[model samples]
Target: MQLTVPDFVGFVGVALVVGTYFLSQMGRMDVRKPLYPGLNGIGAILILYSLSNTFNAASFVIEVFWLVISAAGLIRALLLKSR
Candidate 1:
């Protein structure tokens, strides 16, 4: 599958955002304070949005998996906070 300009941009943007988070978590960069499960939820949304623009089935499936896992993490965080 050929990558359209929009698809490439979206894919790269999502990767950058996620990579930033990873770098921050690993102490490789000090971009911002950890947002805990906040970024997890937001990143999942961004991933799904990017997937919407991608033509690759593998990318779509990976994003769907991330979406589900992030949603679960968010829910768990919320429940723990409420308790």
Candidate 2:
């Protein structure tokens, strides 16, 4: 099968999310840092945008939660950093 732009976006998003998890698992990433949530948020948004092109209910639902949670964490991290 040929790859579309949306599919490529989804793959990049998957890589970002999975890479973050790998770093976290290896103790190389700090969850408390803004970068963590920021990357995850970006990844989730990319995946969601891709989903908008393909329309997967289950993936869409989970990505929505992931995006929301990531946004919350990013906000918290930023607030902490400002202080």
Candidate 3:
């Protein structure tokens, strides 16, 4: 198997997004805030993008479930903040 430019780009993008989330969670980065919603959105987008290159039914279902749960949490947080 060979790596393509798109694959490299996608991997880099995902790494950055996931790394940012972990950094924020660990309290390592203050300026670069990794909000839950933002992280979830990025994750969802990345997973969707990856589906095009290599599709997996099981993985797809799991990712979709994750996206839905994350979105719900984010929405709840926003609502709480607004109140």
Using lDDT as the measure, the top candidate is: 2
Judge candidate 2 at residue 82 and give its lDDT: 96
What local distance difference test score does each model get?
Answer: 0.63, 0.94, 0.66
lDDT of 3 by residue, 1-83 (tens): 89765566557656755776687679875422226655765676676667768778886687677678767767777777777
The reply for model 2, stretches above 4 Å from the true place, is none
Off by over 4 Å in 1: 1-20, 27-34
lDDT by residue for model 1 over 1-83, one digit each (tens)? 88766666566658655776787779985533234445655665665666666557887787677667656766776776677
Tell me the tens digit of each residue's lDDT in model 2 across 1-83.
88889989999999999999899989999999999999999999999989977999999999999999999999999999999
Candidate 1 backbone overlaps, count = 0
Question: Candidate 2 deviates by what RMSD?
Answer: 0.7
Task: After the best TM-score superposition of candidate 3, give how far the Cα of residue 78 lies from its true spot, in angstroms.
Answer: 0.9
Per-prediction TM-score: 0.58, 0.96, 0.65
lDDT score at residue 12, model 1, on the 0-100 scale: 62
Model 3 lowest lDDT segment of ten: 29-38
